[model samples]
Target: MSDERRSLHTENVELQRRLEGLTPLLAEKETKLIKLEQEIEILNNKLKQQIKEIENLKINLEEKLKENLKQKSEGERIEQRFKLNIETLNNELEEREFFEKVFLKIISILKSPELTETKIKSEQREASYRREEHERYQRVIDELNEQLQQTNERFERLERERNELEIKIDELRQKNDILEMELELAHDKMSQQQETSRTLEEKQRELHLQEKEHRSAQVRAQRELEALQSLSQSLANENKGLREERADLEERIGELTEMLNIRENRVKRAAELINEFLERYRLTSGRLKQQIGRQAEDCEEFDRLIQKLRQMPIPKPGLVQNLRICGRPGVPRLEK
Candidate 1:
């Protein structure tokens, strides 16, 4: 930015030199100076606008980056939560398997043939232990009944959790779809911004080219003015020859007029083409909603220029001889 400022300063210094060189030819130096000032002012305003746009784009990108980071963190947190839930479910399943094995073992011990064979040999011992055995069996049955109730409760809780997880999964799917749509919209916005940036860059390049061309034109105009001064001296001394030259000059003027008409037609055609492109661009933007206005943001300058041209009165006498600003499509330039 500083470099650009420096370059503009250099150009201003050069322009001052050129303006000094043209002072002798110019009858209204003060008026021309004021116009130059206005032109420079306009250019500065445009530069400021471009800077503002760049800043806005930077801010937008920063916001998008933050949003993406936030979403990523949220996704990671959800993933961790799911992992913990799965681990807890697996541990509960293992515990349930252990309980089933223990229950099977208890049933097998009660039905064993070894315990029954000892009944005949130790009838007195069996009678003495029978009450204890009955109490132990009752305790085992109570424990089995409690375990069964706990298992049933666990199963019911697991089913409830499974249903809840299903609901969460559905919610997550919907959120995923929403995020996808948001991503798509972000992509579209990025693309649109990129397109606008490219267009502005192209306009800047064209302006630079036009500036260079304008400088060359100034040099040519300076030379032409010098020639005109020399011719005036020669014409003052020779009447007949000067009259012939006057006729030739008139013919040249007519040709120039025709050339001007052709240029005007071309400019009108270019404007129409630009309008057509704007229409299509606007329609596309409208479908997406926002970004492109009904009357495009970039077209304001063009509209102003066109209206100014339309309202311009016919030049009279000496006004045609003076160099002045002529607003064209991409760049404004001096015309005699």
Candidate 2:
């Protein structure tokens, strides 16, 4: 039971360590989740800003197109006025022929390849500027799309990681609950162990007391055995005197009957003493009871009879010579 308790304690300590270890990991996961959410928020703001910039770019492009259309209309008006001036020059040339060379010079200057090339270059520059503007806007849109895609990917990854972290958190919570239950079980086991220990202690005390009592009974049985053996020896010695009175034994039959009655009374008293001992104490020793029973069977009545015989008048010397008391002569604590 103690070993089991130690193992329980060790497991509890290990679980506590695991719990402590997981606490920091859980906190770190939560921090990462928070950071991911913040990053997502930042990306959303950036996207909004990019969308606003696109709106501004569209507005600017519309204004630029309107300005270009106005410039185109003004150019058309100038070209028409130049054509009317050319018609007036042609009429004057036909009428006078004097200004024809100056008019031709003006027309040649107006029709010069350098001027046409310069006009084409200016139109190409305008077209190139518009193309560059469109390309610039397209590049910005592409960049924003790329950034959005990247943000989406990051969001997906963060969401997956967050799901994993949540699962880990749930598992940790379950483990914590299981550990707490195990701790409760361990506490209950410890309580049961304490109870068992107390019960065992009580049993040990009871056994100790029983053993002490058994030892005491054994001592008493030994003393009784010794007393019975001594009494048997005394009776054996008295048997010789009794035999010596063989000639008078027939005449003393009545007296012998009285002595037999006394012996019977002694037997009854010894039985009563054995019953008293049994009734007064718990006797669990089989060997002690057996030894006592054997000794009682041997001389149950004689030892007690010897005790009372000392108080009686001595038999006549001729018939009962050498009759004597035993074992300190006069102690009367004969429990038979």
Candidate 3:
């Protein structure tokens, strides 16, 4: 019985030692569970912060997109307005040309008489002069045509530039669309989060930076649009002034042409008067020649008559008695 009791006591002691070892192991497991829970909480907080940051980024992106769209619209409106003004200027130029052509025709007709006296030697010379005048007129027409062509080309180029700008705007719109989709997904993810930090201060800082950049971009775009508008306005004013100057030059040219025509006509009339005077002098010279011939004949007859009178003898008393005796005595001289 004693041996049995001793064996039972030794087994009891061994069991107590094993129980004590198990107690420390259980305590360690509990500690690990608590640590794991704390780690999970930390990870959850970090995930919430990331989601909030993503949401804020999305908002900034949307605002920037809207700003860009607004800028693009304004630019388009300005471009359209500029194009309309250019068209108006072109129309004015066309009208001015029409009036100038009519004035030139009138001047040409008024000056035709001056050209009539030119000694065009042959049909070829006449044709050549006509051709030269025609070529000069053609040159003026060609220059006007060239100006019109250049204007048209400029208009076309501007239109193409506008098209390119539109295309760029479309591309920006597409990018914004994609960014919006991404932003939507991020918002959905944030909504699913179980917990989130109230003060997204770090995210707000990022958003503020983005907002600042977007605003700066907007200001730049606005300035560019304003500059373009100013350029268009200045161009329109310059074009109008140029048109006025052109009109004035045309008027001056027309007046000078008319004056030249008047001078040419006066010169032609003076030449005709001179020719008439020359003919009158020639007729007077012919009459003087006939009178000189008649006077020469009269002088010859007077000289012969004077010579016959001188040859006749001087009448004396004896001469008279001899002449009477020579005549027959029956002459009735008995009264003597």
Candidate 4:
């Protein structure tokens, strides 16, 4: 039983380790999705500002064109640059959309509970098997206990029989003593009746026969006493052996009880841990879905900005170039 318990403990530890191992990967995926969402938001805001500036430039360009055609060259050059910027923003938007789709796929995969369910089911099956085995051992112990009780009862019966035999032997010995006294009295009477010599001889012969009968009875009583003593000793040894067997069975039952408790506790703890992890996964998945929606909104805002840019006119190169400078310090170069 102790061996069974140790095996169960080992199995529990292994299962817990397997479940814990999945957490880090889930966390990593969530972190990456959040970072991507943040980047998309920043890009969207920048594109919006650029589109607004293009609209303002277009408004100024029309007024400037009617006043002075000499500025046409500068206006054409600024319009070309603005188109290039719009193309770059469009490319960035396309990349962000692709990444957003990939992020959704990752979230969907993470939300799946198939693997966790399988693991939990497997653990439950193993626990059930152990419980069955424990019950089997318990039954065996019960049977051994009953056998021990029966053995004890038999020993008690044997002791009673031996006591009865001893009493009978004592009675037999007293009868032998009484018969010997009678034989002695008969011999003296034979000696006194000496007038008829032949009659006296016949009486002496009868007294000798009675002595022989008494001796035989003594011998039979002694043999019965010896047999009873031997039987009693054998019964005592058997009782001692039964007691030892009972003790061993009791110890085994104790070990099995301890084992069962340990297994029950382990299963409970594992269940709790799995629940916690599952709850955390649900929360993270919810946040990821929200972020995905936010990203989609940001994409739509960028789309609106692109349309505004297409409707706009040109701007002075110097003014637009200065405005296009990075608003945030240490921001990385905007990729096409």
For lDDT, the strongest prediction is: 2
Which ten contiguous residues of candidate 3 have the minimum total lDDT? 327-336
Instruction: Please give the lDDT score at residue 180 for candidate 1.
Output: 55
By lDDT, highest first, what's the ranking?
2, 1, 3, 4
TM for every model, in the order presented, reads 0.31, 0.41, 0.31, 0.25
Q: Please write out the lDDT profile of model 4 over residues 1-336, one tens digit for every residue.
A: 223322433343343444345345445545554554555455455545545554554545444444334334444554565556556655655665665567556655765576567645654675576557556655655665565556556555555554554555465456545555555554454444333444444554654565355345434533443453354345435434544655533443344334333433443443344334334632343343333344334334333433443353443334443323222332211111
Which 10 consecutive residues of model 2 have the lowest summed lDDT?
327-336
Q: Per-residue lDDT for 172 in model 4?
A: 47
Model 2 regions lying over 4 Å from their true place:
1-114, 129-133, 240-294, 301-336
7-92 in candidate 1: lDDT tens per residue? Answer: 43346345444544444434343444455455556545555555555455455545555554554555456556555655665565
Error of 2 at 25 (Å): 48
Question: Which run of 10 residues does model 4 get worst, by summed lDDT?
Answer: 327-336
Report the Cα lDDT for residue 26, model 3. Answer: 50
Error of 2 at 113 (Å): 8.1
Q: Native-vs-model 2 lDDT?
A: 0.50
lDDT of 2 by residue, 1-336 (tens): 223323433443444445455556556555555555555565555555555555555555555555545545554564555455455544543553444455446656687676877756655775576567556655655665565556556555555554554555565456556555555555555565556555555655654565465445544654554465455556545644654665444334334434544554554455455555445433432332443454354353454555554455435547443433244322222111
